[model samples]
Each structure stands twice: as structure tokens, then as C-alpha cells.
Target: MLRKIIHVDMDAFYASVEQLDFPELIGKPIAVGGDGARGVVAAASYEARKFGVRSAISGVQAKKNCPGLIFVKPRFERYKEISTQIRRIFYDYTDLVEPLALDEAFLDVSNNKIGCPSATLIAYEIRQRIYQELGLTASAGISINKFLAKIASDYNKPNGQKTIEPQEVEEFLEELEIKKFFGIGKKTADRMYHHGIFTGKDLKSKSIEFLIENFGKAGAEYYNLVRGIQDSPVRPNRTIKSLGTERTFDENLSSEIFLLEKLDGLVQELSLRLKKSNVSGKTVTLKIKYRDFVQQTRSKTLPYFMSDSELILDVVKGLLFQEELKDSVRLIGVTISSLNTEIKKLPFVIQLEFDF
Candidate 1:
């Protein structure tokens, strides 16, 4: 039986949320992230993108590109609350829901509860429900498999939906830029560019052996992917590997005293979250993102499981200060894992205030 998959992605999720909650931000270029010279754009409103502002770009550059752009610090707690509401909408249709992140997911509705067989119809309903219930808009892609669905969803974004029937899959893939193919990152695309492989058609012309010779094991995977041969199942109840939170600073910090101050705040948040879920762990992790977007993590395992904020803060402080200052730090986060505790995801609640 041909599987029916729907990929749903929230358009500029963080920025859109900002716009939804703040009417003044609509139609204005805004970004949700740090506002400091060394800060990075977490998400950009569509308006901001018009001026070339985008996620991962430095806040300084974004300002230079769009002087009128508004920068708002990220409110992760509010975003998480909204994400839960969106997930509930997905579960109403199918139990086979695989979340890619807080703002995107794949739903396998081949055997959905709706009794209606058209996945495209389900996509429409899901989008409609999200906008009506949460005052948010989502774009959806419907296809026979996840890869095509994910691609199709992005074709018409920010409150739109697309369906790629099985018969149309090959033609669709052939016309795409090589970069759009899953697993082909900037580096791989550069290599493909050097080799004169520029599109799906270019990739398809190469032999599996040649791809393997050039790109090794990943080449084999890419060869199959280009042929539209992905068989990865939509894993709904995938195990929660870890529960952690991190914050991006408005400004990159070179001062050890300032970095420790930020680290302490992160520890407090992580500790509260752990306690809320009644979860504790033996492994504590410290993540650091440099001003240039290079990220690294340092982790240590303790002899006993502990969720005490003071202890977590001490561990993080050691991990962070043990080494000399590298580049200015742009972000810091702390996490504890290995508890095998169940994750706490808030259920979606209908907002009666939203009228659609």
C-alpha cells in the first residue's frame, strides 16, 4: 500500500508567534533572537527576509542589511506552549506523528482516524484547525512519502499547502536544485558543483558506484535518495533522547564573569524544568556557541543522579571556566540526561479567544 505522509512546517515560527501576539509587528520586518552586536538571528519574519535578514546571520549584519528591522529576544516558554497546541492538532488526525522540531512534523495518516482517505484533505483540515484554534498559520505538504512531503510543504509556505501525487514525484524531484535534496548540505553541494552535478537530474546520471567512490557511504545514501527511494518509517513514539534548554545572548561575552552569570541563569531554568517533571540525571552537559556560530559541548557524568540547581551550576561552571577564553561566546545552555525519565509535553488546549 502506498503510504500517505503530510509534512507540516510553521512559517517563520518564532517570528510569526511574535506577530500573532503583537499586532504591531505584522507587515514589519522583525527577528526573534538576541539584539546585540554579536547576536544571531534565530528566526526572521518574512518582512525581514525581504531585506536579506535570516536565521544564523549575525545581528550586526542583519541590522546593516535592514536598519529598520526590529529585534526581539526569544521567548522559548511561550513558543513551547504554542508548539504543544499544534502537536495536539496533529494527534487528532493520526497517532503516527514524528516531530522534526518544535515547529515542524511529519504525520503518517495512511491509516488515520478520520476514515477519510485523502491525505491532502487531511493537510487542509490540519492547517485550518491550527489557524482557527491557535491564531497561527501553517503550511502543509502532502505526498506518498516523507521526503516529497517535506519538499512540497516548503514550495508554498506561510499559510499554504501542496500535494505531490505519486505519479508526479519523479518530475518534481528532477527539477530541484541539488541543494534541495535531503542530506546535501552546503559542503556537499559545493562538491557537486565542482563535479558538474547541479540538480536532481545531474545526481541521477551518476552511478551508485561512482557516488560511493566520491562521497563514500553517504554517497550510497544520496544515490538512493535522489531516486526517491527513501523507506524510512514515520516513527511516532520515538524515544526522548534528552530534555534540555538553552538561551542565545543578545551580545557575545568575552568576560568570564559575565559568562558565569549567564550560565547560572541557565542552570536555574534547567533545574526548574527537571523538577517540574520529577526527573533527575547523572550526566550534566554544557553547550557553548561561539560568535561565529561554531558550537561545542562539554559533558561530565556524576556518580549520583542529582537535580539540585546549585550542584548543576557548579558542574557547568567548572566545565565552562576550565579552559581559557576561546572566541567570544554567543550562546550557553545546560542539560542533564541519562535519567530515562518520561518527557513532559504539555497537551494542546483550545483557545476560545481565537475566532475563525
Candidate 2:
């Protein structure tokens, strides 16, 4: 069956939410993140992007690029609430929804609950409703598969829609820059350029084996993409196989006490998140990286899903003890995997006050 995939992405999600709440910020360029030296740009308004201000760029540098750039602290709670509202809008059309992040998702509406034959029509309705009901704009891409749909969505962005029919796929891809291909990053684009591959036409001329030889296993993927032959499914009910968080410290630490303190904090954070999500895991993994960028991981799978911090600490401590570090630690993280979602929710007050 020819799949109908719709990729929907909110335009400048954090900045849009800011503008929604504060009408004064509507026309101005806004950057959502801290303005301090350590600050990174989390999101940028369309106005900011024109000034070369982008997400993950330093706020200090963004200010230099766009002197008029207004920086705002992120309000994650508000964004999460708005994300829930947007999700409800998607569910009204199809149950086959796969969220890529809080602001973007792909929906397979080939057989929708609303019986909408045209995915473009559904995209228009959803976009209009989001604007009318939430005062937010969205960009929608409609095509036969995920890759094409994602590319189409970004074609006409910030309150726009684009659709690519199967017949036009080849022509559409031929004119596209190789960098614009779904999975090609800046580093890969450099390699492509070095190999005389600048456009889709150049990439298409190469055999699957040639690509694999040059780009490893993903080279075959690039070959298929040039032909618009993506067969990946828009998976719904996606399982969280693992959950973890890591932080790169500004200063390297040789103190074992400080390392343990950081580990303790991570354990608490992961435990709270798992409990809140009503999921538990059987594996405990500890990751550490030295100042030299050398990294190592140690993992152990328990007999059953556990939510215990003490046990987690012991496992991590043991892992740390086994490692002989030659340099100061620059990063540390903890992860839990092999998940089980069966959880009983207790009363909020009781749950907050009591233990398992």
C-alpha cells in the first residue's frame, strides 16, 4: 500500500509560545535561552534566524550577530502544556502518531479515523485549527513516506504546507542539494563534496555499494533516499527502550566525592522521571568520559525492574571503582533500560510523601 505520511513541525516552538504569552514580542527577533556566558540558544524566532542566530549557538555570539536579539528564559512547563494540546489535535485525525520531539511529529493517515483520503487536506485543517484555537502556526509536509514528508514540511515553513506526489519525487530530489537529504549532516556533506557529490543527481549516480564503501552502512540509505525510496514506517506507540541524561562539566574533577555527588543527583533525577512516567527498568548503565574525550560505559541488568536508588548507586560505584582513570572526569551519566510500563498511580499527596 502507498503510505500517507504527514510531518508536522511547529515554527519556532519556544519563541512562538513566548510571543503568544507576550504580544509585544510578536514582531521582534527573540532567542529563548539564558543570556549568560554559559548560555546556549535553545530556540530562535524566524527574525533571529535571518540574523544568523540559531539553536545551540552561544547567546553571546547571537547577540553579536543580531544586536537587537532579545533573549528570554525558557518556560518548559508552558511548552509541555501547549505540546499536549497540539497532540490532541493530531489524535483527532489519526491514531498513528509518532512524536519526534515535543514540537514535531509524523502521522500515518493512510487509514485515518476521520476517513480523510487526502493527507494534505488533513494537514490544512490541523494547521488552521492550531492557528485559530492556540494562536500558533505549524508547517506541514505530506508525502508517501517519512523522509519525503519531512522534506516537504520544511519546504514551505512557518505556517505553510507542501505535498509531494510519487510521480514528482524524482524531479523534486534531483533539484535538491545533497545536504538537504534527511540524514546528511555538515560533516557528511563535507565528505560528499570532497567526492564530487554536490546534488541529488551526483549522489544518485553512485551505486549502493559505492556509497556503503564511502559512508559505511548508511551509504546504502543515501542511495535509496536519492530515488525517494524510503520504506520506513511511521511507528506509533513507540517504546522508550532507555532513559538517561549526561552533562559536560566546565571543569574537570579528580575528586571521587564530587563524582559520587553528581551520580547521586543523576540517580534521583532518573528515579523521579521513571516514576512520573510510570516505567521501570532492569538494567543500570554508568558512563564516564575523561577530559581527553576518552569514554567508557559499564552496565548490569538486574533480575527484575527496579526503582531503587541505593542499588543503582552501588552498581555505579562499583563500575567507577573498576575503572582506572588516567585523567580527570569531564562527564558522567546514568541510564536505565529494559523497561516495563505497568505502574499503579497512588494519590498525589501520598505518592509524594511515601515510598515503595
TM-scores, all candidates, are 0.73, 0.74
The true-versus-predicted C-alpha distance at residue 227 of model 1, in Å, is 1.3
Writing each residue's lDDT as its tens digit, candidate 1 over 20-116 gives 9999999999987666744667789999999999876667788999999999977767888899899998999988898876788999888778777
Candidate 1 residue runs with Cα over 4 Å from true position: 240-299, 302-356
Q: Write the per-residue lDDT of candidate 2 for residues 1-356, one digit (tens) a residue.
A: 57888999999998999999999999999998757755667789999999999876677888999999999987767888899899999999987787776788999887778866788889999999999999999999988889999999999888999999877889999989988988898779999999999999999999988999999999988988899888777766656678886666879988777888778667755664554344678888988898989988889887988765667778778877876776899999999998894333322111011100
Best by lDDT: 2
Candidate 2's displacement at residue 135, Å, is 0.5
